[model samples]
Target: MRLHHRLKEKVLESVSSVLPITVIVLILSITIAPLTPGALILFIFGAVLLILGMGFFTLGVDMSMIPMGEGIGVQMSKSKTILISLAVCLILGILITVAEPDLQVLANQVPAVPNPVLIFTVAAGVGIFLLLAEVRMLFQIPLSYTLVFFYAIIFLMAFCTPDSFVPVSFDSGGVTTGPVTVPFIMALGIGMASVRSDKNSNSDSFGLIALCSIGPVMAVLLLGIFYHPSETVYAPSEIAVIATTKDAAREFLTGIPHYAGEVTTALLPIILLFLVFQLLFRRFHRHQLLKIVSGLVYTYIGLILFLTGVNVGFMPAGQHIGAAIAQSPYKVLLIPIGMLIGYFIVKAEPAVLVLTKQVEEISNGSISQKSIEHSLSIGIALSVGIAMIRILTGISIMWFLIPGYLISLIMTFFVPQIFTGIAFDSGGVASGPMTATFLLPLAMGACEAVGGNILTDAFGIVAMVAMTPLCTIQLLGLSSRLKEHLPPRQPRAKEEVEDCILYFDAED
Candidate 1:
């Protein structure tokens, strides 16, 4: 019954995400130009796959990844051996990040840099930050101070790195933590906090994502110093038309098994680790273990189907549309259009709604889901606008990132601690699979048309999407704090006497 309810909730959230994007596409097609029948069909198919993928991914996290990560966190914390915990965190961080699909996609888009080298460097960054976050939580270190120091290091590295690699470096920070990483990392926080009797256990649970994000930025910045962009041209490709629904469906169906294999490869290591731990710890019963294992299977199947549809049917259309629009006399409209797409795309982000709901529940409704969604939407809108400007003008991403970080760092000191943590975390969550699969390619298309540097101009949409949310969410936090600190109203004399009589009666 619990499993059934969770599945239902996952489906509803996925639908909410996919529906807005579908509506936006429909509006765009009707107003701008009629979409090719093939493109229209592909869009619908992509939406279905995206929602299903989100559902399965969420379920998988709940069943296998979350529990396993949390268990490891608790056990590691109890050891009270700093060296062992640090070693475990570093190794796990690198391994898990290396398998992240979003990061892999982003790496492939970066020109001149070797994919393997980029991947490894980003993974190492995550590992280092994961260790730092764990230590911060265990020792009750303030999140703001660490953020200030680490961001200072990042800014210094930005100056040392080449111009071409700058955007990619910040982008790596955004893409490194997505659907695959969030659930496991959040669960890990819960586990780590379980062992600490401090009043700030919940507070400590909030900043792991913030720290994890820093790892990729710093890693890629260092890489930027070593790597330079080559004079490479990216010519946009024309997508062939699919004549029939059966063709599209058949193509999607056939690729499912392949994706199944891929997701299995991605998930197997974590599953094996969980099983080994379960055997040693014997924490959960046979039935509980079986249920979790079943959930993992559901997640695997869903993800395979989802990825197959997006890559095969949707990506080409997104790129083509962006190129088509950029060549139009109304090319400037791309900014607003991009913002519209971004506003809805975030709704389609699989991990985002999950994070929002969790925040709402954890805060006991002090922070509402609607408020979080609004703040995130505004942030994403600004991000998309900024990305379009970059594509148009070839603006250096560092100019934006340096100021963005400075503002986010300063805000961290003023906002409630939990909001600061969540805001930083939201930066990463807001730019998940949807941004990678669609918006990045859209920017790439625009950059290609304008003869801009793809590495410098087109690459940082994900990072911008990630960065804006930090400021917006903290603003919401500041507002909440203001409300909390407001003085109570004075009672009228009659009302005060009535309250005094009621209090006396209660005491008697």
Candidate 2:
């Protein structure tokens, strides 16, 4: 396809993805929760930017990040020495993660740990686990066993860790695997798997994201145990007040520079790493290199626009709506309302789009993208409903999380191996910047209105969003497995049956 043609297609897809949420918010504003004019205007503006940003971002990933990651992974697989590949993977993990925008948002939310402290700790955790993931894939190890073992350790630590930190720890896992991390990690896994001629190579390419998610949770839980910070308070985002169109425009314009810098910081390390790999391996020709550079430029601009829109434009609207709903007599509607929003909101997550497309490609259309989308939507709806329940009743997050994880883990054995990997990865992908920028703020707003403990009640929405996909997608896989095993219908031994079989055979 021509470049302009492709870009248009992507933008249109983004529109389909973002439009539902926009309509939902608009309806809520008119009926149940009236947003300030300024906030509503900002939200409409943000939704437009979100559509454009996703368009460019997904196209850029197709043009650059996926190729770069796959090329590097292929080269590493060809390396004669194991030590060199391991060292390189560790460095790549840490470098890419340290300045991740999602991780920064997460760090800022938790005032207890210094930003640098939490950021680096989570980065290190990703680095170590990424290395472990590579080894497991290379050695042909089963993904389920590793997940089962690590999760056991994680839950044990959760029991010992401070109560306030449990939700944050799980939230950390969701935020760490954001737009920047998922594409590269997933592509790298595919490249690594390409070298293996075994039957499990395709399935093995999937579990890297699953393992990487575990690291942050485990690391944060350990931090809770040993690193004692005096303040464990949660700081909600400050919503901007705008009185006129000029002020709204000014607000977004002012945000551009800040987000540009943040996006630059996030992309710089990946660019540098890509350059180094290109120099060492000479992987791309002149035309390919030019294309990659163009793609990088698209990625840079797209991310800046995306971050600015969501953080500046959407955050305030989400907060105000939640607060308004919570204060009203009809607060009981929060559960169904949240579920409705969650159903469409996952489509707006950039990483989720990347994951669904990749799954479809890898499965050669055996697993349709529509099916994955529906499953994730169902899962997120349930999760957000659960989160709403927690906010209303002030229930312990552990009460839900324990059973959810246990069920997801138990389901892993019954599903196909490929589904197991995709399920866990979807869990991470479903809870990206959209959940953080909008859903978390929404939860916090409602929590504050109800006079509940924000740390305990509002903080675990992302974790819940992350957890449900593991079970729902696995259930999807289990259904497919059963269908495959069912006995084939015997052709009726009659003239009509013979004629039908003969007709189909003739057509073939």
Candidate 3:
């Protein structure tokens, strides 16, 4: 009964998140970019699946992944040997990232690099940086200094990297930290920090994702420099033709097994790792173990449904709408339309829900999930608008990213440390499967319509989405800091004022 009630609450949250985007798409479909009846029906079904998948996913993460990650982190932190903890962090990071389904999609896109080579390269980068993140936390080092140093290196490499590969490198960073990795990584940070008695412990829990994001960016940048792939190709998603409701159902039906296999593959490592830990540590009781087993099942089902819904249902509709808008007389409406979609779209990102909830809990409600969601939404809105400008004008992405990172890194010095961590983490979480499947396709379709260089323009929308939240969420932190410093006024009593005046008069 308790489980039923929790599931109800989670589904309600998913409804609130997924409905806005659905409504926005519907409005666009009927008014400007009219979708076929079958396409419209598929999209609606996809939205329903998304809501259900998110509900199950969030519940499962709360039950299984969070506890498992936290348990492992606490056990490792309790170990006296630093080398052992570092080794464990590295191994876990590599294992989790290598199997990430989003990373696989990214690897397949760049033809110059062998898929295995790219996958392992990105995974190694994640493992190494995750090690470094742990080292920083162990030594109680400041996150700002670390961010500044690494970003300086990243920019230097970006300048040296081939023009076409720059966006790919940044996009690699965003995709590698997909839905599977974020929840575990964030929970691990919390567990690792829990052992510390220092004031900085809570703040330390966040920057792990931030730092992990850097690894893939740097790795891909280096790969680009080495490969110098002169002309990267962009393949627009093939929009499925749905003439009948049966065809739409057939599309979803075919997608289910494929996603099931992928989700199963994606989840196996975590499950195996958990079992090993359970055997070694016996950290959980029988009841806890049974609940976790149940949660894993929920997570499996959720991911399968979520992936199928997005890839089969949402992708075609997004591409169709984007192409329709770009081909219209009021083509420039793409900017505002993209911005509106961006505002609601991030809310539907599965990982964003996990990140925001964790932030609220870690901050002890000092920072609310609603505030984080709003910040992320505004950031994504701006990014999609900027991306549309690039699609129309064919400008280089560097113009935005360099200055954006500089500002974000500088703000790291000004804002509270916890905000810096959450901000960077938000950047990655905001660009999950929803952005990749829906927003990227939207950009691609628009880019195709405008006859723009899809490689240069459409490829970087994820990077842009990943970049903006750093500044916005940190702005939220800055506001929080200012509020702390500027306390509310309390009116002085008339008696006290009179007493003070009388004393002054006497003294005079």
Measured by TM-score, the strongest candidate is 2
Roughly what TM-score does model 1 have, to 2 decimal places? 0.91
Q: Candidate 2: misplaced stretches above 4 Å? A: 490-508
Judged by whole-model lDDT over C-alpha atoms, candidate 1 comes out at 0.80
**Candidate 2 per-residue lDDT over residues 360-468, each given as its tens digit:** 9989999999999999999999999999999999999999988999999988889999999999999999999999999988998998999999988999999999999
Task: For model 2, give the 10-residue run with minimal summed lDDT.
Answer: 228-237
lDDT of 1 by residue, 1-508 (tens): 6877888888787888788877877776676635677777877887788778878777776677677777888987887578988898898788788888777777666657778988999999999999999889877899999999998998888888776667777888888887777877877887888787777776777888889999999988877676665532333445657788986787677768867766666677567667776787687788878878887787776677667766665676677667767877888988998988888778777678667876886678878988998899999999999999988987788778778879999999999888988898899888777777778778887778777777678877888999999999999999988988999897679988999999999999
lDDT of 2: 0.91
* Model 3, TM vs. native: 0.96
In candidate 1, list every pair of residues with a backbone clash.
none
lDDT of each: 0.80, 0.91, 0.91
Cα RMSD for candidates in order: 5.3, 4.0, 4.0
- Stretches of model 1 off by over 4 angstroms after superposition: 2-6, 227-238, 489-508
Q: List TM-score per model, in order.
A: 0.91, 0.96, 0.96
lDDT (10s digit) by residue, model 3, range 1-508: 6998998999999999999999999999989999988879889989989999999999999998899989988888898999998998898889999889899887778777788988998999999999999999999899999999999999999989989889988998899888899999999999999999899999999988888999999998998888767666756667677888898899899989989988888889888888888898899999999999989888888888898899888988988898899999999999999999999999999999999999999999999999999999999999999999999999899999999999999999999999999999898899899988999999999899888888998999999999999999999999989998997999899999999999999999
